[model samples]
Target chain A: MAAIPRLTSRLRIAVTAPATVWLRGAAQSHTWNRLSGGGDRPRHLDLATLARLRLIPLVGFVVAALAVPVTASATTIYAASSLSKVVPSIAPGNTYSFAGSDTLAFQIENGAPADVFLSAAPLYAERLHSKGLCSTPVVFALNTLTFVTPASNPAGITRVQQLDRPGGYRLAVGGKHVPLGIYTRTLLGKLGLGRALTKNTVSSYQKASDVTSVIALGSADAGVVYTTDWYANTTKLLAIPVPASAQPLIRYEACVVMRPGSDTTAANAVIARLSSLAGRQALFNAHFGLPPKT
Target chain B: MTFRTGLFLGGLVVTLVLTFLFLLTPIAALLLQVPPRDLPGLLRDTAVSSALIVSLKTNLIANVLFLSIGTPAAYLIALGRFRGRPVLLTLIELPLVLPPAVAGIALLTAFGAFGLFGSTLAGLGIVLPFTQAAVVVAVTFVAAPFYLRAAISAFAALDRTQLDAARDLGASEAMVFRRIALPLAADALRAGWAMAFARGIGEFGATLLFAGSVARLTETLPLAVYAQLDVNLDSAVAVGLLLLAISGGVLLVAKLPPLWSSAAPSSTAGGW
Candidate 1:
């Protein structure tokens, strides 16, 4: 009889402890709910709390109805390394853009998202087209290669053939892979001046801008850069003619990257602008030559 | 015990794993990508050889200049009781706060063709821009502060009593500095040297602006890596891997001496 009373007392203590805990939890939750703005609580409570819940799915449905997928409206253009000096002035609305033809090609090959590509050379554009990474490319502008000298013209390098003079003056050229550099080498080779020029060429830079900076800074006696670049830096540099045998006509090309099921209207509009009179004027203003009549 | 705690822990672990994945995987991939056969040919390239030699020579010169000049300057800023000490310290550390590009511009404004010293230098027939000398100047500008800051803290932590004691024993001030101060500050000096060397090696923006990238002349390893990337992607990767390997070796050499000493516990059994 004594053992039964002891057991009953222990049971009563356990039951009362749980009741106190439940009351405390309820008061705390109510205070929190009042402090906050009575935000919605989870409806799917455990079996112990199911009797006090209300069901509502309309709020979630309303939020779902209001949501819309966002798509990028701006076009990103990746331009060639040499065009960096001039392309920014022509981009529509100055949307997100990156410059560097080789870098851009690498980026595209690595699947970087870009809408359009403008190359300093047709070969790169053709390569991208053949790889199915870009649509058919069109030649957009023509450029003439010119030998640039510092304003002082210490070496008096008036013509391209002087690039081969013995004990020749130090010259800066673009890296072998850059389009302008490759073209320059081809022209030098055609004139039988490649070997002699190579001996005097002190360094090769990766960009035309680098070559221009060198010439402007008087680090080199002369360098080859675009006519546009020469005009842009007229005060610091003077352009001397590359002999007809040593100059190559350079052409620039642009292409739109085809995206599956996406509207090509904006891209086609940009292409149209390239062919328009105002666009040609913009090119002329940038010191680039007009596209050869055809 | 609750689901929220479990979710939080899971999220923390995921973040940590992702950080490791993003930062370390590329380096790991580089090591894996380099074939053993190509290493010899890649290292033998005249440009690569020249770049490596230039990097070492320039960094050594930079380190020496940094220590010789920066140590005393740092000590003065750290320990001197002057009205403008805080301001002076801030001025000394200004380069640390400036972006590398801004540092380049700052250097140019002071030393370029249209700069304060430019016309005078031109009169003397001293061209400081776009030359090997310019490379040294640019590296010094960027890397000196790393040594200076380390040295300042090291000097500040030194016990003044040791120096006073040396002086009281009739030792010359130079002797005290050489024997007492330098020995005690050896570790800090080593750390400073490491920082200066690393900074010199990694210096790009200031170098590009001041020295200009001229292959085999002004081009250091980083510039070489950039130049190679333009001509040959494989060669670029090879250079990058070489840089990575050298950096790894430096870190290992810095740490392994201590690890080896600890590992050979028996070697220290007779130590006083």
Candidate 2:
């Protein structure tokens, strides 16, 4: 019975206490400042006055953005997200924007500022070429799709056939139009397990890296990703080589983007390095397959 | 008009118009790309229809969960004069500042198959990540705080004297809450829920990271837009417009008065 009054008092103070505490803290700080011989000055902004003042920075940002192209020197390379790990190592000095190849192609078509376009699949590069957004696609490297499971093998998957076994396991793949996604579906279709595999797919990521992450995190029982992706995450993933009969010939294509104000000379040089002996060796070391001889 | 005064007014109007245009241009672009005449055909695509169903179902479940669980928690924080109350509020509001990507990874580390309680959850025959349930959890983590913060403010703003009088009349805490606090805070609570629902329906990064985007399973509207981007630009634009319309409708409906309340003449103002 006596607890009710205590509770009521506490409730009454609870809502208003923070304001008083803040005021008391401010007062104590002011006293300390005076004792230390510091000059008095209010430390808070007058928000009403700031309403107009804020536009100065906004205008400055607009001006700076407009002025950037005049002095921009670094070559901007738009590469597929799959090349994110290897591209910088191959060529260390350029600005790179890594995303889905299809997305990069679409952006180049829609006028994104890119000097070079490197894609995991020839399809996106061909699309850009047809649109006159880039040079003719060049097959610089090749990759093959492989099955990867979490190191723990949570679903106890040992072979590809179990992917469609009874009491199905979760599988993560790339999105429908993603190069890896297209290749995975093609591989499954060739193996005559397409229907069953589609049923087992739980997530389709836009980035191949995301598919690897999901598998590595044990969020999915298994996933299909590039041979290079599997090698990059070797510690977290156990790879199951795709059967040769169904393995798709995954090609890495590159071309110089034809946007206005782009550094085409530098972009072409970047492409040259990718197809050069050192670049092919670097890709080989990273487990990417070399393109067939012309 | 004085030159300086006229200049200030003109500058203010220009700023307002610029801000409005900045906000509206993207919406206008979406409308132009995917006009109303093409919506029905876009909806016929199984991926778009499945994504819409998944979004509505998951967000609905998430909002209901928020109302049931969040309201009581807010009341406790507002009224409980406990130690660490400020800390508690900060923890509740932390998700508001956390990038949705960070929230996704946090969820993964805490609840994923190999997370902190991985074996414990596995023992219980539960796998949270990569499912519709995971979608619900992702949205709840990021969106619940919006409702909780609003609810705390509303409950704290209640008339303490009326509450005290009710207690003096021998009303139990539950009775006082149901009879007084709940009714008074109803409007703000609805608005908070609507905001949360809007945020949940459009949740992308976290859901993509935590739940995985499988059409008809875990893909919400935003994920659908991303997925469609690579497939068909027009389809992606159509889905984005649908999401915008749904959010707009939620805000509109939440702002309007309840039909029953509006239908009845207010006794407080009646002299007829």
Which number leads on DockQ?
A: 2
Put down candidate 1 lDDT per residue, B1-272, tens digits, no spaces.
23443443465478689799989999887766768688778768999989888777777777678888887777777667879877877787888878876776677667766568877887899876667777888899888887888888888888888778667777787776666666666667667667667777878777766676666667888888877877777777888887777666665565444443333222212221
Pairs in steric clash, model 1: A80-A101, A81-A101
lDDT of each: 0.70, 0.83
Put down candidate 2 lDDT per residue, A37-141, tens digits, no spaces: 546565343222332233333454566778876666789999988888888899888999998888888888989999999999999999889988889989999
lDDT (Cα, tens digit) per residue for candidate 1, span A141-162: 8887777898888668887777
**Model 2 chain B: worst 10 consecutive residues (lDDT sum):** B263-272
Local accuracy of candidate 2 as per-residue lDDT tens digits, B201-263: 889989998999877889898999998888789988889988999999998999998876644
The segments of candidate 1 whose C-alpha lies over 4 angstroms from its true place after superposition are A1-71, A81-91, A154-160, A165-168, A190-192, A259-264, B1-19, B97-115, B122-125, B161-172, B255-272
Docking quality band of candidate 2, CAPRI definitions: acceptable
Q: Count the backbone clashes (under 3 Å) in each candidate.
A: 2, 0
Give per-model TM-scores. 0.77, 0.86
